[model samples]
Target: WDEEPFELIVSNPPYSVKWVGDGDATLINDPRFAPAGVLAPKSKADMAFIMHSLSWLAANGTAAIVCFPGIMYRGGAEQKIRKYLVDNNYVDAVIQLSGGLFFGTSIATCIMVLKKGKSDNKVMFIDASKECIKVTNNNKLTPENIDRIVDVFAKREEVAHFSHLADYAEIAENDFNLSVSTYVEPEDTREKIDIKKLNAEIAEIVAREQVLRSEIDKIIAEIEG
Candidate 1:
Protein backbone atom coordinates (compact mmCIF):
# COMPACT_ATOMS: atom_id res chain seq x y z
CA TRP A 1 0.00 0.00 0.00
CA ASP A 2 3.06 2.27 0.21
CA GLU A 3 4.35 1.88 -3.33
CA GLU A 4 3.72 4.15 -6.29
CA PRO A 5 1.69 3.12 -9.35
CA PHE A 6 3.28 0.39 -11.38
CA GLU A 7 3.56 0.03 -15.15
CA LEU A 8 1.22 -2.99 -15.34
CA ILE A 9 -1.72 -4.09 -13.22
CA VAL A 10 -3.41 -7.50 -13.10
CA SER A 11 -5.90 -9.06 -10.73
CA ASN A 12 -8.96 -11.31 -10.34
CA PRO A 13 -11.60 -9.52 -8.36
CA PRO A 14 -14.93 -10.70 -6.91
CA TYR A 15 -17.89 -10.70 -9.28
CA SER A 16 -20.39 -9.05 -6.94
CA VAL A 17 -20.53 -6.49 -4.14
CA LYS A 18 -23.89 -7.38 -2.53
CA TRP A 19 -24.73 -3.68 -2.76
CA VAL A 20 -26.82 -1.45 -5.02
CA GLY A 21 -25.15 0.74 -7.65
CA ASP A 22 -28.00 3.12 -8.51
CA GLY A 23 -27.90 4.61 -5.05
CA ASP A 24 -24.30 5.74 -5.49
CA ALA A 25 -24.71 9.27 -6.85
CA THR A 26 -21.01 9.65 -7.69
CA LEU A 27 -20.58 6.43 -9.71
CA ILE A 28 -22.65 7.45 -12.74
CA ASN A 29 -20.23 10.16 -13.89
CA ASP A 30 -17.03 8.30 -13.03
CA PRO A 31 -14.52 8.99 -15.86
CA ARG A 32 -13.19 5.44 -15.71
CA PHE A 33 -16.28 3.74 -17.15
CA ALA A 34 -19.01 4.60 -19.63
CA PRO A 35 -20.18 8.23 -19.68
CA ALA A 36 -23.82 7.40 -20.29
CA GLY A 37 -24.64 7.34 -16.61
CA VAL A 38 -23.92 3.62 -16.84
CA LEU A 39 -22.49 1.80 -13.88
CA ALA A 40 -22.51 -1.87 -13.10
CA PRO A 41 -24.99 -3.12 -10.54
CA LYS A 42 -23.23 -3.12 -7.22
CA SER A 43 -24.32 -6.72 -6.77
CA LYS A 44 -22.44 -7.66 -9.93
CA ALA A 45 -19.18 -5.77 -9.65
CA ASP A 46 -17.07 -7.64 -12.18
CA MET A 47 -17.24 -4.77 -14.67
CA ALA A 48 -16.52 -2.30 -11.91
CA PHE A 49 -13.27 -4.09 -11.12
CA ILE A 50 -12.36 -4.23 -14.81
CA MET A 51 -13.01 -0.50 -15.22
CA HIS A 52 -10.92 0.29 -12.18
CA SER A 53 -8.02 -1.70 -13.54
CA LEU A 54 -8.36 -0.02 -16.91
CA SER A 55 -8.35 3.38 -15.28
CA TRP A 56 -5.18 2.57 -13.32
CA LEU A 57 -3.38 1.06 -16.35
CA ALA A 58 -0.45 2.92 -17.85
CA ALA A 59 -0.62 4.26 -21.36
CA ASN A 60 1.67 1.48 -22.65
CA GLY A 61 0.79 -1.13 -20.06
CA THR A 62 -1.78 -3.95 -19.96
CA ALA A 63 -4.27 -5.27 -17.47
CA ALA A 64 -5.47 -8.83 -17.31
CA ILE A 65 -8.66 -9.32 -15.36
CA VAL A 66 -10.66 -12.47 -14.78
CA CYS A 67 -14.40 -11.90 -14.82
CA PHE A 68 -17.69 -13.69 -15.01
CA PRO A 69 -19.23 -14.44 -18.40
CA GLY A 70 -22.05 -11.94 -17.95
CA ILE A 71 -19.70 -8.97 -17.89
CA MET A 72 -18.48 -9.71 -21.41
CA TYR A 73 -21.77 -9.43 -23.37
CA ARG A 74 -24.63 -8.26 -21.22
CA GLY A 75 -27.04 -5.45 -21.94
CA GLY A 76 -27.62 -2.07 -20.23
CA ALA A 77 -24.69 -0.74 -18.22
CA GLU A 78 -22.51 -3.71 -19.13
CA GLN A 79 -23.00 -3.20 -22.87
CA LYS A 80 -22.32 0.51 -22.44
CA ILE A 81 -19.11 -0.05 -20.50
CA ARG A 82 -18.02 -2.72 -22.95
CA LYS A 83 -18.76 -0.29 -25.74
CA TYR A 84 -16.62 2.32 -24.06
CA LEU A 85 -13.70 -0.09 -23.70
CA VAL A 86 -13.90 -1.58 -27.17
CA ASP A 87 -14.66 1.72 -28.82
CA ASN A 88 -11.51 3.12 -27.27
CA ASN A 89 -9.53 0.17 -28.63
CA TYR A 90 -8.44 -0.89 -25.19
CA VAL A 91 -9.55 -4.52 -25.24
CA ASP A 92 -6.88 -6.90 -26.50
CA ALA A 93 -8.16 -10.37 -25.78
CA VAL A 94 -11.21 -12.18 -24.44
CA ILE A 95 -10.52 -15.77 -23.44
CA GLN A 96 -13.25 -18.25 -22.67
CA LEU A 97 -12.42 -20.59 -19.81
CA SER A 98 -13.59 -24.11 -19.11
CA GLY A 99 -16.34 -24.70 -16.61
CA GLY A 100 -15.65 -26.55 -13.34
CA LEU A 101 -12.12 -25.16 -13.26
CA PHE A 102 -12.55 -23.16 -10.07
CA PHE A 103 -13.43 -24.45 -6.62
CA GLY A 104 -16.77 -23.61 -4.94
CA THR A 105 -18.23 -22.67 -8.32
CA SER A 106 -19.08 -24.28 -11.63
CA ILE A 107 -19.95 -21.10 -13.52
CA ALA A 108 -17.87 -20.70 -16.67
CA THR A 109 -15.59 -17.66 -16.52
CA CYS A 110 -13.72 -15.49 -19.05
CA ILE A 111 -10.44 -13.58 -19.02
CA MET A 112 -10.41 -10.02 -20.31
CA VAL A 113 -7.01 -8.68 -21.27
CA LEU A 114 -6.94 -4.93 -21.82
CA LYS A 115 -4.02 -3.04 -23.29
CA LYS A 116 -3.62 0.67 -23.74
CA GLY A 117 -2.04 1.67 -27.06
CA LYS A 118 -2.20 -1.96 -28.17
CA SER A 119 -0.44 -2.77 -31.40
CA ASP A 120 -3.38 -4.52 -32.99
CA ASN A 121 -6.66 -2.86 -33.80
CA LYS A 122 -8.51 -6.14 -33.86
CA VAL A 123 -9.24 -8.10 -30.69
CA MET A 124 -8.30 -11.76 -30.29
CA PHE A 125 -10.91 -14.14 -28.93
CA ILE A 126 -9.61 -17.50 -27.78
CA ASP A 127 -11.91 -20.36 -26.87
CA ALA A 128 -9.75 -22.32 -24.48
CA SER A 129 -12.60 -24.02 -22.70
CA LYS A 130 -11.56 -27.31 -24.31
CA GLU A 131 -7.91 -26.81 -23.37
CA CYS A 132 -8.37 -28.16 -19.86
CA ILE A 133 -7.73 -31.68 -18.56
CA LYS A 134 -9.77 -33.24 -15.84
CA VAL A 135 -7.98 -33.38 -12.52
CA THR A 136 -9.02 -35.03 -9.24
CA ASN A 137 -12.20 -32.98 -8.84
CA ASN A 138 -11.87 -30.08 -11.23
CA ASN A 139 -10.57 -29.26 -14.68
CA LYS A 140 -7.07 -27.85 -14.69
CA LEU A 141 -4.87 -26.01 -17.17
CA THR A 142 -1.72 -28.07 -17.55
CA PRO A 143 1.69 -26.98 -18.70
CA GLU A 144 0.78 -27.89 -22.24
CA ASN A 145 -2.51 -26.09 -21.91
CA ILE A 146 -0.92 -22.91 -20.60
CA ASP A 147 1.86 -23.14 -23.17
CA ARG A 148 -0.56 -23.53 -26.05
CA ILE A 149 -2.54 -20.50 -24.88
CA VAL A 150 0.58 -18.41 -24.35
CA ASP A 151 1.85 -19.44 -27.75
CA VAL A 152 -1.39 -18.41 -29.38
CA PHE A 153 -1.38 -15.12 -27.51
CA ALA A 154 2.14 -14.41 -28.66
CA LYS A 155 1.50 -15.28 -32.27
CA ARG A 156 -2.20 -14.43 -32.50
CA GLU A 157 -2.67 -17.30 -34.91
CA GLU A 158 -6.08 -17.88 -36.47
CA VAL A 159 -6.44 -21.59 -35.80
CA ALA A 160 -9.79 -22.93 -36.94
CA HIS A 161 -12.28 -23.69 -34.19
CA PHE A 162 -9.81 -22.57 -31.53
CA SER A 163 -8.96 -18.90 -31.96
CA HIS A 164 -9.88 -15.90 -34.09
CA LEU A 165 -8.53 -12.41 -34.57
CA ALA A 166 -11.73 -10.44 -34.97
CA ASP A 167 -11.77 -7.03 -36.53
CA TYR A 168 -13.03 -4.19 -34.38
CA ALA A 169 -15.73 -3.44 -36.91
CA GLU A 170 -16.91 -7.01 -36.74
CA ILE A 171 -17.08 -6.78 -32.96
CA ALA A 172 -19.13 -3.62 -33.23
CA GLU A 173 -21.44 -5.33 -35.68
CA ASN A 174 -22.16 -7.98 -33.10
CA ASP A 175 -23.32 -5.28 -30.67
CA PHE A 176 -20.17 -5.61 -28.57
CA ASN A 177 -20.74 -9.24 -27.59
CA LEU A 178 -17.46 -10.50 -26.16
CA SER A 179 -18.42 -14.09 -25.60
CA VAL A 180 -15.57 -16.23 -26.92
CA SER A 181 -17.93 -18.71 -28.53
CA THR A 182 -19.13 -15.80 -30.66
CA TYR A 183 -15.73 -15.72 -32.31
CA VAL A 184 -14.05 -19.09 -31.77
CA GLU A 185 -15.94 -22.33 -32.10
CA PRO A 186 -14.82 -25.56 -30.46
CA GLU A 187 -13.59 -28.21 -32.88
CA ASP A 188 -16.29 -30.60 -33.95
CA THR A 189 -15.60 -34.37 -33.75
CA ARG A 190 -18.03 -36.89 -35.18
CA GLU A 191 -17.46 -40.36 -36.66
CA LYS A 192 -19.39 -41.35 -39.77
CA ILE A 193 -21.55 -44.45 -39.14
CA ASP A 194 -21.34 -47.45 -41.54
CA ILE A 195 -24.66 -47.63 -43.34
CA LYS A 196 -23.55 -50.70 -45.28
CA LYS A 197 -23.04 -52.72 -42.08
CA LEU A 198 -26.36 -51.53 -40.71
CA ASN A 199 -28.18 -52.59 -43.90
CA ALA A 200 -26.51 -56.03 -43.79
CA GLU A 201 -27.62 -56.55 -40.16
CA ILE A 202 -31.19 -55.54 -41.08
CA ALA A 203 -31.27 -58.01 -44.01
CA GLU A 204 -29.98 -60.83 -41.80
CA ILE A 205 -32.68 -60.14 -39.26
CA VAL A 206 -35.39 -60.20 -41.97
CA ALA A 207 -34.06 -63.51 -43.37
CA ARG A 208 -34.12 -65.08 -39.90
CA GLU A 209 -37.67 -63.84 -39.32
CA GLN A 210 -38.88 -65.31 -42.66
CA VAL A 211 -37.25 -68.69 -41.91
CA LEU A 212 -38.95 -68.79 -38.48
CA ARG A 213 -42.29 -67.84 -40.07
CA SER A 214 -42.01 -70.62 -42.68
CA GLU A 215 -41.14 -73.18 -40.03
CA ILE A 216 -44.10 -72.12 -37.90
CA ASP A 217 -46.51 -72.21 -40.86
CA LYS A 218 -45.44 -75.73 -41.86
CA ILE A 219 -45.70 -77.02 -38.27
CA ILE A 220 -49.20 -75.55 -37.91
CA ALA A 221 -50.34 -77.07 -41.22
CA GLU A 222 -48.98 -80.47 -40.27
CA ILE A 223 -50.74 -80.42 -36.92
CA GLU A 224 -54.05 -79.36 -38.56
CA GLY A 225 -53.88 -81.90 -41.42
Candidate 2:
Protein backbone atom coordinates (compact mmCIF):
# COMPACT_ATOMS: atom_id res chain seq x y z
CA TRP A 1 0.00 0.00 0.00
CA ASP A 2 1.10 3.55 -0.69
CA GLU A 3 0.14 6.84 0.94
CA GLU A 4 -1.09 9.73 -1.14
CA PRO A 5 -0.14 13.35 -0.62
CA PHE A 6 -2.56 15.35 1.49
CA GLU A 7 -3.60 18.95 1.05
CA LEU A 8 -4.03 19.47 4.77
CA ILE A 9 -2.26 17.77 7.64
CA VAL A 10 -2.92 18.20 11.32
CA SER A 11 -1.26 16.51 14.26
CA ASN A 12 -0.40 16.73 17.90
CA PRO A 13 2.87 14.87 17.90
CA PRO A 14 4.41 13.59 21.09
CA TYR A 15 5.64 16.50 23.17
CA SER A 16 9.31 15.55 23.54
CA VAL A 17 10.92 12.22 22.74
CA LYS A 18 14.55 11.22 22.76
CA TRP A 19 15.26 10.02 19.18
CA VAL A 20 19.05 10.00 19.09
CA GLY A 21 21.85 7.90 20.63
CA ASP A 22 21.73 4.14 21.21
CA GLY A 23 22.76 3.55 17.58
CA ASP A 24 20.13 5.91 16.23
CA ALA A 25 22.64 8.16 14.48
CA THR A 26 21.19 7.07 11.15
CA LEU A 27 18.41 9.63 11.68
CA ILE A 28 20.83 12.37 10.78
CA ASN A 29 21.05 10.99 7.26
CA ASP A 30 17.29 10.64 6.80
CA PRO A 31 16.01 12.55 3.78
CA ARG A 32 13.40 14.40 5.81
CA PHE A 33 16.00 15.83 8.17
CA ALA A 34 18.85 16.09 5.66
CA PRO A 35 17.46 19.33 4.23
CA ALA A 36 17.60 21.05 7.58
CA GLY A 37 21.35 20.16 7.62
CA VAL A 38 20.98 19.44 11.33
CA LEU A 39 19.06 16.78 13.17
CA ALA A 40 16.91 17.50 16.18
CA PRO A 41 18.76 16.48 19.31
CA LYS A 42 18.47 12.84 20.38
CA SER A 43 16.74 14.05 23.52
CA LYS A 44 14.22 16.03 21.47
CA ALA A 45 12.37 14.69 18.42
CA ASP A 46 10.03 17.62 17.93
CA MET A 47 11.82 18.76 14.81
CA ALA A 48 11.94 15.24 13.42
CA PHE A 49 8.16 15.14 13.18
CA ILE A 50 8.12 18.67 11.89
CA MET A 51 10.53 17.78 9.11
CA HIS A 52 8.61 14.60 8.34
CA SER A 53 5.34 16.48 8.06
CA LEU A 54 7.04 19.05 5.91
CA SER A 55 8.43 16.36 3.68
CA TRP A 56 4.99 14.91 3.24
CA LEU A 57 3.36 18.29 2.79
CA ALA A 58 2.05 18.91 -0.72
CA ALA A 59 3.34 21.95 -2.53
CA ASN A 60 0.10 23.80 -1.85
CA GLY A 61 -0.79 22.10 1.37
CA THR A 62 -0.49 23.24 4.96
CA ALA A 63 0.33 21.40 8.14
CA ALA A 64 -1.05 22.57 11.42
CA ILE A 65 0.82 21.01 14.30
CA VAL A 66 0.58 21.28 18.03
CA CYS A 67 4.07 21.58 19.41
CA PHE A 68 5.82 21.98 22.69
CA PRO A 69 6.64 25.57 23.54
CA GLY A 70 10.31 24.80 24.07
CA ILE A 71 11.03 23.89 20.45
CA MET A 72 10.17 27.39 19.23
CA TYR A 73 13.06 29.16 20.99
CA ARG A 74 15.32 26.48 22.45
CA GLY A 75 18.90 26.75 21.31
CA GLY A 76 21.29 24.16 19.79
CA ALA A 77 20.18 21.66 17.13
CA GLU A 78 16.52 22.69 17.56
CA GLN A 79 17.51 26.27 16.94
CA LYS A 80 19.39 25.23 13.83
CA ILE A 81 16.32 23.45 12.45
CA ARG A 82 14.22 26.54 13.22
CA LYS A 83 16.75 28.66 11.38
CA TYR A 84 16.44 26.43 8.35
CA LEU A 85 12.64 26.52 8.41
CA VAL A 86 12.48 30.28 8.82
CA ASP A 87 15.21 30.92 6.27
CA ASN A 88 13.39 28.89 3.65
CA ASN A 89 10.11 30.75 4.27
CA TYR A 90 8.14 27.58 5.05
CA VAL A 91 6.66 28.78 8.30
CA ASP A 92 3.19 30.29 7.94
CA ALA A 93 1.84 31.19 11.35
CA VAL A 94 2.55 30.45 14.98
CA ILE A 95 -0.16 30.68 17.60
CA GLN A 96 0.48 30.71 21.35
CA LEU A 97 -2.23 29.10 23.47
CA SER A 98 -2.54 29.74 27.16
CA GLY A 99 -1.64 27.29 29.87
CA GLY A 100 -4.20 25.01 31.60
CA LEU A 101 -6.01 24.47 28.31
CA PHE A 102 -5.00 20.85 28.17
CA PHE A 103 -5.99 18.17 30.57
CA GLY A 104 -3.45 16.54 32.91
CA THR A 105 -1.12 19.49 32.38
CA SER A 106 -1.17 23.23 32.61
CA ILE A 107 1.93 24.01 30.60
CA ALA A 108 1.36 26.35 27.65
CA THR A 109 1.52 24.93 24.13
CA CYS A 110 1.79 26.47 20.67
CA ILE A 111 0.64 25.74 17.13
CA MET A 112 2.99 25.80 14.16
CA VAL A 113 1.45 26.21 10.73
CA LEU A 114 3.70 25.24 7.85
CA LYS A 115 3.20 25.69 4.17
CA LYS A 116 5.23 24.62 1.18
CA GLY A 117 4.03 27.45 -1.06
CA LYS A 118 3.66 30.78 0.67
CA SER A 119 2.02 33.88 -0.77
CA ASP A 120 4.14 36.21 1.30
CA ASN A 121 7.58 36.28 2.89
CA LYS A 122 6.26 36.86 6.39
CA VAL A 123 4.92 34.79 9.26
CA MET A 124 1.73 35.48 11.17
CA PHE A 125 1.86 35.12 14.94
CA ILE A 126 -1.27 35.02 17.09
CA ASP A 127 -1.11 35.28 20.85
CA ALA A 128 -4.30 33.42 21.79
CA SER A 129 -3.11 32.43 25.20
CA LYS A 130 -6.13 33.94 26.86
CA GLU A 131 -8.73 32.65 24.37
CA CYS A 132 -10.28 29.99 26.53
CA ILE A 133 -13.06 29.55 29.05
CA LYS A 134 -12.39 27.95 32.40
CA VAL A 135 -14.28 24.73 32.74
CA THR A 136 -14.49 22.34 35.65
CA ASN A 137 -10.94 21.02 35.47
CA ASN A 138 -9.41 22.57 32.42
CA ASN A 139 -9.61 25.55 30.10
CA LYS A 140 -11.61 24.90 26.97
CA LEU A 141 -11.63 27.00 23.86
CA THR A 142 -15.14 28.28 23.35
CA PRO A 143 -16.68 28.50 19.92
CA GLU A 144 -16.39 32.26 20.11
CA ASN A 145 -12.80 31.95 21.13
CA ILE A 146 -12.09 29.58 18.26
CA ASP A 147 -13.90 31.90 15.87
CA ARG A 148 -11.90 34.88 17.01
CA ILE A 149 -8.66 33.00 16.44
CA VAL A 150 -9.72 31.64 13.07
CA ASP A 151 -10.79 35.08 11.93
CA VAL A 152 -7.46 36.58 12.84
CA PHE A 153 -5.57 33.67 11.32
CA ALA A 154 -7.46 33.83 8.07
CA LYS A 155 -7.16 37.57 7.72
CA ARG A 156 -3.51 37.49 8.74
CA GLU A 157 -4.00 40.93 10.18
CA GLU A 158 -2.14 42.40 13.11
CA VAL A 159 -4.74 42.83 15.83
CA ALA A 160 -3.48 44.72 18.82
CA HIS A 161 -2.59 42.39 21.70
CA PHE A 162 -3.76 39.49 19.55
CA SER A 163 -1.66 39.00 16.45
CA HIS A 164 1.26 40.25 14.40
CA LEU A 165 2.61 39.54 10.96
CA ALA A 166 6.38 39.50 11.00
CA ASP A 167 8.55 39.63 7.91
CA TYR A 168 11.29 37.15 7.14
CA ALA A 169 13.92 39.77 7.75
CA GLU A 170 12.37 40.54 11.12
CA ILE A 171 12.46 36.86 12.00
CA ALA A 172 16.06 36.54 10.91
CA GLU A 173 16.95 39.64 12.88
CA ASN A 174 15.58 37.87 15.96
CA ASP A 175 17.66 34.75 15.26
CA PHE A 176 14.71 32.78 13.84
CA ASN A 177 12.97 32.36 17.15
CA LEU A 178 9.45 31.09 16.21
CA SER A 179 7.83 31.53 19.58
CA VAL A 180 4.50 33.38 19.12
CA SER A 181 5.20 35.48 22.18
CA THR A 182 8.33 36.70 20.42
CA TYR A 183 6.21 38.33 17.76
CA VAL A 184 2.71 38.89 19.19
CA GLU A 185 2.49 41.15 22.17
CA PRO A 186 0.12 40.05 24.89
CA GLU A 187 -2.45 42.46 26.29
CA ASP A 188 -1.44 44.30 29.43
CA THR A 189 -4.47 43.95 31.71
CA ARG A 190 -2.94 45.72 34.68
CA GLU A 191 -5.08 48.61 35.85
CA LYS A 192 -3.76 52.03 34.96
CA ILE A 193 -3.42 54.33 37.94
CA ASP A 194 -4.42 58.03 37.91
CA ILE A 195 -1.55 59.84 39.59
CA LYS A 196 -3.72 62.82 40.57
CA LYS A 197 -6.38 60.66 42.21
CA LEU A 198 -3.76 58.63 44.02
CA ASN A 199 -2.05 61.73 45.37
CA ALA A 200 -5.36 63.19 46.56
CA GLU A 201 -6.15 59.98 48.42
CA ILE A 202 -2.74 60.08 50.04
CA ALA A 203 -3.32 63.66 51.16
CA GLU A 204 -6.70 62.74 52.70
CA ILE A 205 -5.12 59.91 54.63
CA VAL A 206 -2.40 62.26 55.95
CA ALA A 207 -5.01 64.79 57.08
CA ARG A 208 -6.90 62.09 58.98
CA GLU A 209 -3.70 61.01 60.67
CA GLN A 210 -2.97 64.64 61.72
CA VAL A 211 -6.46 64.99 63.20
CA LEU A 212 -5.99 61.75 65.16
CA ARG A 213 -2.65 63.03 66.50
CA SER A 214 -4.28 66.32 67.61
CA GLU A 215 -7.04 64.42 69.48
CA ILE A 216 -4.43 62.27 71.19
CA ASP A 217 -2.50 65.42 72.29
CA LYS A 218 -5.71 66.91 73.76
CA ILE A 219 -6.33 63.72 75.74
CA ILE A 220 -2.72 63.78 77.00
CA ALA A 221 -3.03 67.42 78.11
CA GLU A 222 -6.26 66.73 79.99
CA ILE A 223 -4.61 63.82 81.80
CA GLU A 224 -1.61 65.98 82.71
CA GLY A 225 -3.90 68.69 84.10
- By summed lDDT, the worst window of 10 consecutive residues in model 1 runs over 1-10
lDDT of 1 by residue, 41-116 (tens): 7678777788878877778887888888987778887898888888889999998889888889887888899898
Q: Show the colliding residue pairs in model 2.
A: 20-42, 98-129
Provide TM-scores for the models: 0.83, 0.89
Q: Cα RMSD for candidate 2?
A: 2.3
Off by over 4 Å in 1: 1-6, 34-37, 195-204, 207-215
* Model 2, span 78-192: residue lDDT tens: 8999999988989999999988887778889999999989999899999999899888878899999999999999999889988999998899898989988888776778999
Q: What is the lDDT of candidate 2?
A: 0.89
| Model 1 score (lDDT) | 0.84
CA lDDT, candidate 1, residue 25: 82
Model 2: residues >4 Å from true position, as ranges? 1-3, 21-25, 100-105
